[model samples]
Target: MLPPSVFESAFNSSPIGKYLLSPTPEALILAVNDAFLKACSRRREDLLGKSLFVAFPADPDDPASSTNEAELRASFARVLETGTPDLLPVQRYPIPLEGPDGTIAFEERFWSAYSAPVFGPDGAVTCISHTTKDVTEQIRSERALRESENRFRALTTAGQVVYRMNADWTELRELDGRGFLRDTDSPRSFWLQDYIPDDEQARVHAAVGEAIRTGRVFELEHRVRRIDGSDGWALSRAVPICDAHGRVVEWIGAASDITERKAAEEKLRESDRRKDEFLAMLAHELRNPIAPISAAAALLQRMQLDEALVRRTSQIIARQVGHMTALIDDLLDVSRVTRGLVELERVPLDLRDVLQDAVEQVAPLVQARRHTLALELPSQATIVVGDKKRLVQVVANLLNNAAKYTPEGGCLAVRAGAQDGGACVEVSDNGIGMAPELTGRVFDLFAQAERSADRSLGGLGLGLALVKSLVELHGGTVGCESAGLGQGSRFLACLPCLSGDTAPQGEQDDEPMAQAPAALRVLVVDDNVDAAVMLAMLLEASGHEVLVEHGARAALARAHEARPQVFLLDIGLPEMDGKELARRLRAEPATRDALLVAVTGYGQDSDREQIMAAGFDHHLVKPVDMERLEAILAGAA
Candidate 1:
């Protein structure tokens, strides 16, 4: 053994932290090496001769320090009693330091310690030697690594595949060893060949090549094949890992499933295409009726005709005008239904009465087609809560559809009964039945079956759609069934039944004639000269004083001169619109009290409300019915 002075010098200079505690109940610190003094951030003079626990007490502010102090004291007591070394687990033992402000502060630390007994010549424990190693940085690094692994596991569980690849795009491997790709053995050059669909291979390859060449982020959406041999959509993104010299060394990437999102995008595109087709069809249908009306007007003006020819030509004009009006009305009805603006007038009524009216309305078409018609009504009346007019229209549309599609002598049947706690009406026809696929979508707006070049079975494909909307608004449902093309077709409408008293009897009246009222002053104002002239002629022929004006200024001048009792104005005027003209006229005493009627093609509910708000008493849409006009005249008189 070396001399005491030499041993003390060697102990103080040792690199490993060492401290000696006197073999006493208090475990007083006798001496400490320079390494131990540095480890605790203290001077030897401050620690020597003080109790070990008292000199470095457990930090009351740190909960972990108490556990560490207890474990350390147990190891020291065991070493002193048995004269053997006792090792302790790594522990968080914070040391106290005097700050520049003279306040005691704790320096957080983790330590690996071993306590050994130093025996004296008498074979008794004289002192306890404790050795320590500071391992704070190592412990912190291990904790961070554990957290990273947990995050990686979570991402894998969420269906995200993490991949690593060479910077040159020549090799690839899934980081988690989960075979997300179908062909795990394939190289980078052929990686997408087996996974991605053939149609998307070129685009995805190009994107990958560009990203590698420019060291930019790679992003692509492509189709992938699953283990079950099914196809799905995936979105892949990757970033380049570069070396210190800014040279690409590796790439990390992830891919997520996006099949549902892609499907939604495709559906939206299909809807847009269908909307475009419907708009084109609408334009074509409108032109068909306008062409004949234009030619008839030109013929009447250019030629002298016999009375029979004149009457025939007039009838043609009337029929075409009616057709145009029906088309416009259907368009408006669809707009109203789609906007949730259609309000139904619900009333308790007999389903049989509605069926009777609908059958009568379509009798002309049924007779023209020469179809054999059969009617089946229940033994008892079926009562339902519904809108009477709308229910009638729904059944009438179904009957008309049957007549239009059936051959010259096909069979048609309409049945009304009670079923499933509801009143049901069904119309079936042995005509050009629809295909199985079309049965499901026949009631879709603008959905039409195959038609001939002449479009002889003319329609805007809005009838069934309107029926469906109206029926649903009445708290009912409509459905169609077909056996296949040319076999037959059937439509059924069901409305919730109501148990109540009998429906009120409807009034029966003879058709009223368009009789002239006692003569009264009338003014017709329209932007179209022909419309103004035609209206004026009709009013004059009815024995009323009539004047025509083609513009707002002209109509204002005419009203001032004539002081007309009735002022008919178009809503779309040149400099000032009809609403403005009506406003100006209402401000004037001469026309304020006159019966103001707005005549225009704009007939939406909002348009009518606007015109009425502008001081008009009535609003009549274009191609106004003669009977309605006659009634208005009589009412005014």
Candidate 2:
């Protein structure tokens, strides 16, 4: 038996827990700290210095008891020889035994068992020092905490936004796909690995140096790595997270996907530039008609009363005004087509009927030029789903082109029938045919075929292009063909046919359009004298009492004299545009009740809204028409 002081020394050296030991031959003896022994039903005097098999006893017949007895004896002998402890698989178990008071008191305990050999002063094996550590709840808690951390890490790394950073941007630490603490060969890394070109690496390195110097943010946009492994533009912003002493610690950043936004902005800018070019071309085009119309109107306005000459010059002014209106309408159509904002009113339209109306409208022009128009439309209806008014415009443009391009006595043929399982229409003219190269670009905006040097060809190239857009919008296509220059040109249109052919009544069934009251006193104002008079003349012929002014000051002077019911003012003037002039006019009681109308080439929808808000009641695009003018005057609103 060990002395009390020696036992105290061993107990103090060891933590407060249960322990196990084996005697030299074969015996199960356990040593426990006072803290552990207090929970036992066995008396302290009985526990110490007693045979451990008596203190904490087990059944000799049980498998656990016999197996543990053999293992303890074997391990003790081996530790004595080798001077090392041995671990056992069974970490926890209860030793069933008797207690003090000579009563059968059950002792229930959990422990981690350990066995090491003890030596005497002669260095001979005396016993195996053994221990049992009570740690039933601690191991379970650590395992649960480890599991929770692993799950959280997995969730974070799975997201695209989460990333690990190196103190320097030179290298990156990759995150697993699940964000867990495991790695694969293809882990998620930073964008620096790609995107930057080989030549541009030096530049980026210099930029990194600057960022490190000032500890400021690095802002840049460049083509960078994408998740798909392809390259795209990235808007990257990185900022240095500094230490307490103001030294740079680490840099962190976010890269946003800006590829689509950049592309869309470029497209919008291109569209705006095209519009500016078109407007400039429009101004140049309007000058052509304004000059001739102004010259003719000025000559007629100065003439005295000769009924024959008066009538003849009036016809010239009228013809020129019509030509100008056609051109202006074409420009408006181009804007509408380019923006993809044209809405179609789908009514069942018969192609033959539309072609006939177009043919009749061009009959007078064809007659004067002595060009023969041949019609080859099928008698039956060639049904289509379309807007009737737009269809009329399309056919009118084709027929007009046929008549205008064909020389006097040349044949212009129109054929509408079924072809290629769809409704096909062909317009052919025996005129100076176009070159192959010209045919390719014929439908481009502002494109025109060069005629003889006199340059008398009237139409802009906007019509065919507009028609092509309109046709495609309705799921149709159009193309032009020619047998080389000077032979002829043929234009064919193929439109999808309507479902089952029971059609509605023709447009003659809806002919009675609105008719307002008679024309009111209307004022026409412009910077150009001829434009103002010709507009005035057009309205006058349409049955309104018309007044004309050359400029804004003159217009303000005449506003009271005319007591106009409506003012058609141009926006471009020397002193001010018609919009500002209209504001001043609206302030005057003389023209207070009069409806102000703006007539300018700046006819974009947004521009029109601006003029209207500036006190104008109506807006008209430049180059007037007699019929539309009559409609406006009659309504006078």
Report, for every candidate in turn, its global Cα lDDT versus the true structure. 0.81, 0.68
Clash total of candidate 2? 6
Model 2 agreement with the true structure over 486-602: per-residue lDDT tens digits: 898999878988644659446644322335548687777887887777677766765778877778888888887768888888888888777789899989988877888788887
lDDT, candidate 1, 108-202, per-residue tens? 88889988888889998888888888888788656654553344322233355778888877777766435554556654553566666788888
Instruction: Write down the TM-score for model 1.
Output: 0.67
User: Which regions of candidate 1 are displaced past 4 Å?
Assistant: 1-158, 166-172, 175-194, 197-218, 227-230, 240-249, 449-456, 500-514, 574-576, 580-593
Q: What is the lDDT of residue 78 in candidate 2?
A: 74
- The deviation in Å at residue 511 for candidate 2 is 10
Q: Which candidate leads in lDDT?
A: 1
Score every model by TM-score: 0.67, 0.46
